[model samples]
Target: MFMNWRRIRKWHFLRLISMCCVVSLLMVCWEHVDHHVVSHMKSYSYRYMINSFSFVNKSLSVSQEEAARFNSFPYLLNQNNVCKDKDVLLLLFVKSSPENFERRQAIRSTWGNESYVSHELGVILKVVFVMGVHTDVTNSFLLQDLHEEHKNYGDLVQQEFLDTFHNLTIKLLLQFRWMHENCAHARFMMSADDDVFVHMPNLVRYLQDLRRRNVRDHWVGHVHRGAPPIRSKNSKYFMPFDMYQWNSYPDYTAGAGYVISGDVAAKIYQATLSLNASMYIDDVFMGICAIAAGVSPQEHVYFSGEGRTPYHPCIYEKMITSHGHENDIRYLWKAATAPEVQGISSGLVGKLYCTAVKMMLLCKPYFSNTYSCMAAFT
Candidate 1:
């Protein structure tokens, strides 16, 4: 009887200790937990309310005088003749840093080869690299090299601004401004990073279909909906209250790569003129501009977010853009555009095999940032 009483006492003591520890842990982590979970919920609710009432445009509006300074930088290097005599189908603007010469070359030799695209796809796709001058004084020598490169390729579009992370919105302005002035008649325009891998054939086919259907106001990519702003100072994308007090950013596509029809591109350009460009995060600024123009982004499963897609024939068969391909672009271009990739989805057996392969690759408890699991069935 004595031992039974002691056992019960010990069990109660342990339970009390466990409960105390759990409570202490919760107390210690409450701030962090609240910041992430509760803050996000509040942000989502607020975003939904504002979006439903169509108040985003008014909330993000800026004075016209302030907006005039956004795209006022003069062009140091310009190409006014890229789409001169061609019925251009796609005007692709590659956002490259001044020092990414190697990446530009790799693209030229691989999927961005204009000659290959014209011969194979029988469509006029113009690829132009947009950039700002290097800020570092030591890298001043690169200016001559850049000029020579532009002279050689005639595809570089540069402006007189420092190439810094905060100036991404400036670069964004450059693309649309150039398109508005020069390539206004192109059917579609694509903005992409130098490191992104674009499967030219698949993209051409998709755009061709859209053109046939006369799709307007079309902007498609990997969409981020209800994304909360990063408040931590350590984050590169941190948004301060003074900059953007909003809890959630308007729905925007990832800046790594995205496509817009010619009409939509024009609308975005006009929106930039009126909306504030001080929101230096280019993609978020794009969302604000899109909201002002009454345009919404369309999500495509094949468009990757910040992460690269898994390497497989099944993925290659449908991929539009894969981010973070700084090194293996050549090899990936060869493998992804191989003739056999077409055969992998031809007949019933091949289709089943690819579908099963995609399911295994994409269906995971954790998100892959690439294609969603539903892409396997499609």
Candidate 2:
């Protein structure tokens, strides 16, 4: 009886200690939990309860006079003849920084090679590099090199604004406005960062199939849905309360690479004319513009979401674009486009083998941004 009483007392003492520890932990984590977890819960609830995103349209729209300032920058290097009077299938806009000459050149020799697309893929794809003048005064000498590049390739489209992180919205404006003025009739327009590796052969075939079906209002990429905004000031992608008080942003695609039909491109341009472009993050700004324009982003399994894909033949067989491939783009382009890759998933034995391999590579407890677990079964 004495021992039983002592054991009960010990159990109560341990329970009391555990309760205190849990309470202390909750107190310490309350602020972070409230901002990230509670805010997202509230925002997602509000998102579904609303009828339409018309409120976002009202909040982001500005007067035409105010909007004109965003698009009024003069072009320093213009390429009016890049797509003039041509049956262009795809107009690819590579958003390159002023200093990434090697990346641009690597792309041109690899996936951005227009001659290869025309001869091998049988599609007239126009590739153009869009950038702004260097912001740093000490790097002024590079302008001579830029001028030489423009003279040689005639594919550089630059504006007068400084190329900085905050000016990315301005660059986005440059792409849409340039397309509006020059290549509005192209069947599809793609915007991609210079580091992204695009499988041109696969992409050309996909676009050709869409064209044959005359698909309209199509915009496809790696889609982010119901994502909460980062309120932490230290974060590079921080969103202040004054700028965007909403807890969640509308669905958007990763700006690393995405494709929009010509009609959707025109819609986005018209939306840009009235919407305020103060959101410096180009991909979020794109989501805002798309919301205002009533175009929804579609998710493609093969498009990467801000992460590099595992180097594998099964992955290359269906990949449209993979992000964060600067150093090995040449090697990936060579390996991914090899003639043998096309037959890796053809027969019964091949399909089962590739599916198992993809499962091993893609299905993980942690997030793998290349493709989802469902991709393995598919």
Backbone clash count, each prediction separately: 0, 0
The C-alpha stretches of model 2 lying farther than 4 A from their native spots are 1-39, 49-51
Which residue pairs collide in model 1, if any? none
Report the lDDT tens digits of candidate 1 across residue range 241-329: 88787778888999999999999999999998877787899999998888877788999999988889999988898899999999999
Worst 10 residues of 2 by lDDT: 44-53
Provide the clash count, candidate 1.
Answer: 0
For residues 102-155, write the lDDT of model 2, one tens digit per residue: 999999999999999989888899999999888774676798889899899889
Off by over 4 Å in 1: 1-36
The candidate that achieves the highest lDDT relative to the unseen native structure = 1
Prediction RMSDs, each to the true structure: 3.7, 3.5
| lDDT for each candidate structure | 0.90, 0.89
